[model samples]
Target: MSDNFPPPPPEQPQPEPERPVPVQPSPWAAPAAPPGKQRTGLIVTLAVGGGLVVAGAVVALVYAAMSSVQDSIALPPRSETPYSEPYEEEPYEEEPYAEGPSATEADAKKDVTITACTRDPQIGWQSAKVKVVNGSSTTASYTIMMEFLDEDGVKVAEGGAGVVDLEPGASAVKKAQGLGEVPPGTTCRIGDVWRTPSDRSGS
Candidate 1:
């Protein structure tokens, strides 16, 4: 019996299975960006299958919408220049005047004559140029008044100027200004004149 089975060959030595190799961990690397962020507006291709007779690919189409973007900001309104009007001085009623003119003043006004009546180009007020002659026999000073009147003779403005130390029978020119702004076609004239005697004897 032993010859027939021929004692089983001595068990051959079995080589030890190879120890699993510990693959060195690849150097730490940054993870890829999420699909939503990376795949936008891009075309992608994919393949599936190893057992089929013909090579085939699974085509998945991901549509990404594209649109134009515009940036704008609101701004405040622009500033404009303000309106301007003609200038005016104090009102005519604010002037100092008595109820009535004295006899000498009324007589002196006759000696004062208005030469030119016009509007001031710079201040836009009425003005009058008057010639005052000291017709009395003594040295005197005179204050002459100007009145601005509308076409209907309505007084609109009044002003005055003084001529001092005028000798007897001597003449002088002075400008009288109007206080208020008069209308178009308005007239200016000498309103009144008052004389002050400084010396009894002619000087």
Candidate 2:
């Protein structure tokens, strides 16, 4: 190899092919859903949640309103109301006292004495008598009326008799009879008779 002569050019090595690098796919890069479907799902979820909240609020409001109404209500007092009617009641009635026997001072052409015979009930025929006494110096006239009252105070019988121009102290005997049943609970007595029927009825 002469110095002056150029050395043979060094042999150039050929470059080796580059190896392919392994790449990892990104996790956030999934396929997107349709816009309409995504929007529909979001709307449905919100609607359900809003409906539940609204329902709860409505229930609370209703309960509060009812409670307030009940507290505000008031009732009337029972004692303030009147229970009885404002009218008068019927009157009481009783038996007649003119049904038995009586005596007067105007009978027997002289003076007579009137008296009561029996005050109690008689089994069959009942009678009372009177006596004649000449007590007055002048003639006397007698007009006597009698009534009978039973146990129940009802009028069972009544009668009357009269003696005109009796001599002084002259007496007469008279009796009354009837066919009515006597009730219990009262006693018998001879009643005085007035001249008028209205008086007798009222008595």
Candidate 3:
């Protein structure tokens, strides 16, 4: 009877507690970088810096070469005085002309006409120019005489004594030199007559 009572008490069941599931790490988590890869990036940065330094040196050398080339070029020396045309010993001659009308009258018919004329002051002497017209029907020969006068109406210098011949309806030029000094005056005039030395001294 005691063995049958103990077997009847073994019928009660027992319950177990619930356990949580284990989680796996994310796939996108950063990995440990390789030492060789890190060293490669450092080498690339150093190479870029070295290349920039080389480029800067090359640019500096180029600039120095250009400056040296510029300095080596030769240039002519400059002059302080204003330049003028060289003086010629021989006087200029004009073309031959033919006479058609007198140069005195304003309405006189002329075969030739004066084109251009000017004058320039020199350091020691004064220069002048004149153009003459042939106003005649036939060819004629003539001479131009320039007389420089002082304020007292006295002739000082004389220029142009050579003969000038002009073709019909042509123009000519006459150049000459003076024997005395040039004087200053408010009024100026062009004349055909030339005063001789004896005549000037006599007056």
TM-score of each: 0.46, 0.28, 0.32
Work out candidate 2's RMSD over C-alphas: 16.3
For candidate 2, write residues 17-98 as lDDT tens digits.
9998987778889867799989999999999999999999999999999999998888665696768878887887765554
RMSD in order of candidates = 21.8, 16.3, 20.2
Question: Which ranking of candidates, highest TM-score first?
Answer: 1, 3, 2
Can you list the residue pairs that collide in candidate 1?
A: none
Error of 1 at 162 (Å): 0.6
Worst 10 residues of 2 by lDDT: 193-202
Give the better candidate number (1 or 3) by lDDT.
Answer: 1
TM-score winner between 2 and 3, please give it. Answer: 3
The whole-model C-alpha lDDT of candidate 3 against the native structure comes to 0.53
**Model 2 CA deviation exceeding 4 Å by range:** 1-128, 131-137, 178-188, 193-203
Q: Tell me the TM-score of model 1.
A: 0.46
Specify the poorest-scoring 10-residue window by lDDT in model 3: 194-203
Steric clash count of candidate 1: 0
